[model samples]
Target: MLNNVAAVLLDGVHPFELGVVCEVFGLDRGDEGLPVYDFAVASAEGPTLGTHAGFTVSTPYGLDRLEAADLVVVPAGSTFATRDYPPELLASLRRVVDRGARVLSVCSGVFVLGAAGLLDGRRCAVHWQHADELARQYPRAVVEPDVLYVDADPVITSAGTAAGIDACLHIVRKEQGPEVANSIARRMVVPPHRDGGQAQYIERPLPRSRCDTVGEVLVWMERHLDEEVTVEQLAARAHMSPRTFARRFQQETGTTPYRWLLRQRVLLAQRLLEATDETMEVIADRAGFGNAAALRHQFVRSVGTTPQGYRRTFRGSQAA
Candidate 1:
């Protein structure tokens, strides 16, 4: 029943967000025996619209086209965070859901759905950068900033730019099957399914050198991830008591010494997985995980996938 689709655009639509929707539903992949959707872009503003990228996109379809859509997509716009959505467009969204259809929003497009009141009590996934504002604007919506996407049943929301691919593929996987979704993902040269949430992608800035701090200890920790070192030993090296060293470490790095070390180990393991052809056991030992089983456990917990899976993703299964 998931056939017809429409990507609704506003005045300042971001082309990449619009492209993600079009790539998922608008392409005619009949040559590969894929299900082709009755897809088109509909403009809320007018027939012609300017893109955030300083380009123009035209669509003959309008809000009327959304009425018949089995799935409706709202792509983020330049001022979606502050701009007002057209009331008619919001009404059409509500009507589409009322008629038992599904709706999806990429990035700030969730704001449009919020305006429609569709996300009133629903769990929503939004980019971390906008999560605060989204929560502020739609206090009733449960904003999950860490996740890549959330399938709040009829309403799907995704985080950031590429996460839209994750949401689209998830819907395809749900409706058609894993094979269809995977095939489409392969054609797009993206993963059919990503392992972890956005937490794995967030930047972890390490403390840098200054006159006196945990900078040298951090440098030592980074160099000696393969070795086992105690907080007492680190404290002794820093010429401070264990309690003071622990506090200073936490203050400077924004995390406990144990957590910082574990994260560093995981990071090293990731780099080794991506660039080296070492076996899991070897990589684990080098990264201080001790064994493959431990590596797999910690890797999955930290990266949302096994070391082998992560390696396969970053460096294809077959060696070059």
Candidate 2:
């Protein structure tokens, strides 16, 4: 089992990402009958290192602490994408992996594993903002830009800030079972597992040119996900031809109307599954799928797992 854990820190590390590791592994959750890891924070820079938020974190443990850890986590640093990692740190990471232990990275920390050559010929996940740079820097590594995380077994890499929580919980679920992971997530007040990929979150994050051409139509579509409306109907609502409305919708939303609506429906179904004890048929109707069978097909297609399987993983078998 994963009894020992270590978080290897470098200067300019993001505190929230580091906190994700500490919260999931370092805390004494024995009261909840969960495993209490033998956890430590090791500094690669020195006894004290500065953070990107204009603060400093001091730790007595050093690289030697990583030797006994079953899992080593590298949280993101502000400059990790461009900065060179210490040879000693890279060597320690490779040593742990060589010993059959695992190494996980949060966000830009994936660059450290890339530098250690661990990611060579492996598929990895990174924050969408840095995905291009990661690919440009490590040509041999396959970078997946839009997934919450990738489990390449010995090396797990995750996307942005919140994705770190998903990765850590995933590790718990994989090693300790769904019950422990779900209990911890309940205490943390976050979902035990998230559905869909980061692709859903990345669509049209930036604001369009203030013209608000299709803003009203987009809002209407969001409120009426259950309705089977065509582009012609949406065009009538927007007072434009079907062709012009479709083109403008694509330009403004960075996705087609049908695709966007489908993604939204999937997202809604995920929330209902996590937060409520709803039946599949009910959830399907509420999320625009019409029936359990249709919901199951679309849910598995979009989330890589069946509805019941996902509910069981996140909510435990009794709840499922």
Candidate 3:
């Protein structure tokens, strides 16, 4: 049902974000039995728009092209966070959603959605750098700062660059099937699905210290994900008191030790689920979850999907 797609652009649009939308929805993948969208690039400012990369893009399509789209994408721009959108473009977006079509924003493009009044009372995801500003600008919108994407139906929002790919594939997976989304991902040479959120990508400013004591512990922790180690034990390994170690870990990593361990374990489980045909119990033990039930609980909490479901989706795509 999601056949027609259009990317509406403004001046100073980030080429990568525009390319993300184009790559996902503009290509004719029907050769591989994948759905082919009737795609176009629409210019909100004019027929010719300059990108932040010091190049110009000319499109035959304009805002009028959006009327036929089942999905309209607003790709990120350099000044989108502060720029004013054309009233006509914003009105078109509102009408598109009003008529049951979906609209999606990649990174800073979300600010445009906020301008269109589409984000009111909806949970949205944006690049972490823009999350606070977006929340301040659109006080009614719930800004999730650390997620890859948020699907508030009809108005999906994604975090920076690569997150747009995830959101686009998610839309494909939701509308078409895992097979189609996976096939597209295979062609793209990206993962069909990624575990976890943007928290890991955020740059935490560690304290200016003479030694990176926590970094050493992180390396050890990564290597021994299957090992059960208490914070007290890890603190001992770091040659610091448990309280000091905990504080240092939080300061350096922006998360507590338990959360960091849990996230790492979940990531390990995801990789295992995708790559190995191991039983749930085996994976649970290997990922330090101890049992399938624990793995399922933590996996569901972190990845938002059951291990079995994740495996099925992953393997299904690989099979395709």
Candidate 4:
């Protein structure tokens, strides 16, 4: 359904994020019988676009190609939170979206989509650094910070950098089939699917000035995800009172210590579910959730999908 795709390249675009869109959708592997895309990179005003590295990229097509695309990709651009988006490009993006085609955004591109008003009522995901800015700009958008990507019906948004691959693969899986997506991923030499969301990569809070202490504490938490870790225990490692620790910890990291620990535990559960043949109850226990029901509740709350269902849908069909 989405064989025709377009990637909108804005000025100050990061090369790798633009390359991710090209890697996933612009490759022509005709021998594999994959659905080759009608892919082209277009500028906002038919001019040579500048990248973050101070280089210019010339494009053949302009904003008009986006109107004909079944799927439009907005790749990451630098300083999107600080930059001004062209009104004409914004209008063209809105017009295509109004016609019912899907719009996919990578990293800070969510800011551009938000500027265009397409992300008004939708749930969105962005680079962790820009999450607060996006929330500030579009208070109406349900901002998801726990996941690498958020698929809100037709408009899909991904967090920074490598998450763009996952987002694009999700689109391929949804439009064509799991089989085709797996093929593309294999050709790309990455995992056919990533197991968890952005939980594992989230930075934790530590009050201490010593960097090694924080690392030791985090290692302990990750290894013992199956057990309850009170703030007091973590505080003992840092040798600080609970009250002072909580306050300073918040300053060191953007999130609370408890929330960071809980998300990692959930991601651990995700790995076992996706890669192992273990039962849900056993996986739940290993992930610190006492029962399958608890695991299901948390998994759905954070990931928008069930454990068994996610595994079945993205489990290693490439192995087959």
How many clashes show up in model 4? 0
lDDT of 2 by residue, 1-320 (tens): 79999999999999999999999998999987999999999999999999999999999999999999999999999989989989999999999999999999999999999999999999999998999999999999999997889988899999989889989998887777656887899989987665324442544554464454788887799799888889999989988899998977876655788888887798678777877899999999999999999999998987679989888876799989
Off by over 4 Å in 4: 195-320
Q: How well does candidate 4 score on lDDT at residue 143?
A: 88
* Segments in model 2 whose C-alpha atoms lie over 4 Å from true places: 195-320
| Best-to-worst lDDT order | 2, 3, 1, 4
Alpha-carbon lDDT, every model: 0.85, 0.88, 0.87, 0.81
Higher-scoring candidate on TM-score, 1 or 2? 2
Q: Which residue pairs come into collision in candidate 3?
A: none
Greater-lDDT candidate between 3 and 4: 3
* Cα TM-score per model: 0.64, 0.67, 0.68, 0.65
* Candidate 3 lDDT by residue in tens digits, 1-320: 89999999999999999999999998888887888889999999888999999999999999899999999999999888887889999999999999999999999999999999999999999998998999999999999998889989999999999889989998987676656777899999987754325352634444465364587888799899999999999998888999999988877766788988898898788778877888899999999999999999999987678988888876785432
> Per-residue lDDT for 77-185 in model 1, tens only?
8889898888999999999999999999999899999999999999998888899999999999999987888888799999889888889998886676556787899
Question: Which 10 consecutive residues of model 3 have the lowest summed lDDT?
Answer: 195-204
Q: Sort by TM-score, best first: what order?
A: 3, 2, 4, 1
On TM-score, the stronger of 1 and 3 is 3
User: Residue-wise lDDT of candidate 4 within 1-320, one digit each (tens)?
Assistant: 78789999888898999999999999998888988889998888557988999898998889988889998899988888888888988998888888989888999999999999988889888877888989998998988876778888678999888888988998886666656877899999965655325442534433355653454666688788988878888878767787766655555544578877777777677667656788889999999998999999998987678887777765654321
Candidate 4 at 197: error in angstroms?
A: 3.9
| Clash counts for all predictions | 0, 0, 0, 0
